[model samples]
Target: MSDISSFGATAKGLAKNPIGIIALFIVLIYGFAALTLGFNPKLEFWERVPLVWFLVLFPVAVLALFGWLVSQHHEKLYAPSDFRTDDIFLKKSQISEKREADFQASNEELDRKILEIVNRLSKEQLEPEKIAKQVAKEVKDATTFIVDGRAFLGRPDAVFTYPIAAFETLGALTDEVYFKLSKSVRPFQYGTTWVLRNESTGDVIRTLRMLTATPPGQPLTDIRTLREVGIHPGNTLVVEPPPC
Candidate 1:
């Protein structure tokens, strides 16, 4: 009875995500079809050929259709408006120049903030609150940094560079801080020792080095959920360089 209840809860949890529901539906359909084909000893040669063909082709077609639907949904959700034409007529050179200028300015500002945090860490007296404030002020986008030698930064309007599952896991670590930051930011690389500090107390909560490509069913120590990390509210998270 207890085992059945636990299985029911697991199924219910999986059903909550549309992707999971779709995947489970596909698996059940395929499994049922396979079982039916295998058990039906009365199937004629012609019938078996067509049935086998249908079974093979149907799932591929369904998966392709699902992919197309997801792509269309993402474009609609995140694509910029085509209605705006103010800069449509601008020359390519002019647009490039403007973008480069903005990128440089943003990069400079980020560098300054990183340096400030480094200096603060070097001090004999470490104030977690001050460190957190400095980081919160500078890190407006939490999705731009490199993790474990892989770049997670995507286009300005992109939902994510990696799988949504990975992002959800990372978000679990960052908590509310992920929501506060912009979804878009300039991409940058970092060393292996990068740590996420509590914005208010400056205590190390997570180490980004643990964010490697973890296999399914494996635990990601660096990207563990907030509950797993045991972080409480009022703790703003900031990415920092390796300790000196």
Candidate 2:
């Protein structure tokens, strides 16, 4: 049904245009002139040719030239439209813009919360007790749990897990103890604990252990019965008397 409508529309458009009518007339006239020239020797022979030959040939040549000219004009008018409706270019641009806006909005909100946390921590002395209080205040609606690795100084055997997104923002929690406690520098690993230094003392005595799982099913506190608990810190032991 749609194809029939499209065909009717095309026919109507062609019927309304003078160029199509004129082209048809020129073709008919050119055909007649060709037939007349074939039989009429007086029109064809240069020496005895009649004025009608020039008259018919001139008009046919002019109309033929106009047909080509009209086609070129039509082509130029419609050519630029080919790229305007491209789905990959225009649609992809819209998708990219939407994603960029969403990302920026999310980053702005996250940054605001991070600034508040950093500002509160900056005002207080860097201590385990105060940091915990600040964390509780800042991260609203998040499940908060504490892992106490009391023996980080001796064996570096504490394990923790935390959300990677939150960790990415906070960067590495560094303190004086981490720099001064041991000459060794252990890189943070996934599903493993790394010592968090007391920012004030640079001591690895008590490190903040994170539960690194995304669904965060890993135990934040050491579960002696569960072997698949949170990852253990490299070269460190979780002290019995947890700091938290």
Candidate 3:
């Protein structure tokens, strides 16, 4: 999830306008000043220096200017406050996402162990269905199944993935899952449309144009209708213009 965009997303963010790009040269200016200082270690280096205080004060002034440039145009160049998805904060998102993925993987592994036990019991002339029902009583909080939604945005053609719970609906896919995917596309509900297509056949399975969050029983985003529309795992959702 942290690999949110292609290379140069940060560069593009800073390149929005001329004023925002001044910060890029800060390091170059400092590098040139250091080269100008020469490599002499003479004892009279301090006294013989021309305006020695410029060395001390100039760096502070340059850093302050850099901070000012970032602050002024941050709204246009940075992610929203909630996501903190600028390049600097992307590492935090990566760490958090790794932890969540590990936790979900652990949950799925536990479910697999239970199924293994059921298979072993069935071989012993015992009723597996009856025992499986008993086992299903536990760990029933909707974490047992996960669906991979390989999603791509139209304009940039950048591909990203979102995990869909087996029980999640179309409304939840956008309003909850995709919304948390990136702050750059926040508030994705307005006039937003999705095309769910078969990965092999390249056929359109479903189309959802959500005006509101998933309602309680709307057919548009219903997970229960997956069988009716031939939706399965690894289906792709293309934003806007669908696909060829």
Off by over 4 Å in 2: 1-85, 128-244
Q: So what's the TM-score on candidate 1?
A: 0.29
> What lDDT would each prediction earn against the true structure?
0.49, 0.43, 0.48
Q: What is the TM-score of each candidate against the true structure?
A: 0.29, 0.20, 0.25
Instruction: Give the candidates in order of TM-score, highest first.
Output: 1, 3, 2
**How far in Å is the alpha carbon of 62 misplaced in model 1?**
2.4
| lDDT, model 1 | 0.49
For model 3, how does the per-residue alpha-carbon lDDT over 188-241 read when each residue is reduced to its tens digit? 332333444455566654434432445323444333223334443344544432
Better of 1 and 2 by TM-score: 1
Better of 1 and 3 by TM-score: 1
User: Candidate 1: which pairs clash?
Assistant: 128-201, 128-202, 132-199, 199-236
* Candidate 2 structure quality by residue, lDDT tens digits, 143-198: 22233343544555433433212221122222222333334433332123344443
* Position 100, candidate 2: lDDT: 51
The local distance difference test score of model 2 is 0.43
For residues 109-151, write the lDDT of model 1, one tens digit per residue: 6677678776876584667787777577546432143222112
